[model samples]
Target: MQTSPENDLVTIEEAAAMLGTTTVNILMNLKRNLLQGQEIDGHWHVSKASLAAHGGDTKAAVSKPLCQRSTCGSCGQH
Candidate 1:
């Protein structure tokens, strides 16, 4: 829950708590590019704007992949 004095950016753990989600979920958003992130000193950095835009510290909504013919769990296309 450490804050960066340079930009006042909060850590992922803090963002998760503020957003009511797990850190892993936050990382997922970052990985999928659903949420904007910056790498500082080899670490991922999130901006307050990104968090606020996502509902004041909430998990960013990600598009779930549509079940394709090759991997439709329900239809067993595979």
Candidate 2:
């Protein structure tokens, strides 16, 4: 939530919101090493730099509304 030049720790929910994706997607990316994150207090904290590096602002990739369930199964809602 508090992002500074030294520590830009963002919650998984925050990263998902920024990336226009779901928390599961972010977690999957973390597991696959596509994104960099640190586990703190049993929760994942991602860096703003890492998000930027992984093309976090990929709103274009999210075609459906966040609340809508996808039939394609790409959003992991199926």
Candidate 1 local Cα displacement, residue 69, angstroms: 14
Model 1: pairs clashing at backbone N, Cα or C within 3 Å: 19-57
Can you write out model 1's per-residue Cα lDDT over 1-78, one digit (the tens) per residue?
577554746677766777776777667667756566676676666666767776632433322322233553423454
| Global lDDT of model 2 | 0.69
Off by over 4 Å in 2: 1-6, 55-78
What TM-score would you give candidate 1 relative to the actual structure? 0.61
- TM-score, per-candidate, Cα-based: 0.61, 0.64
Model 2, C-alpha of 1: deviation from truth (Å)? 4.6
* lDDT, residue 67, model 2: 27
The RMSD of every model to the true structure, in order and in angstroms, is 5.5, 5.7
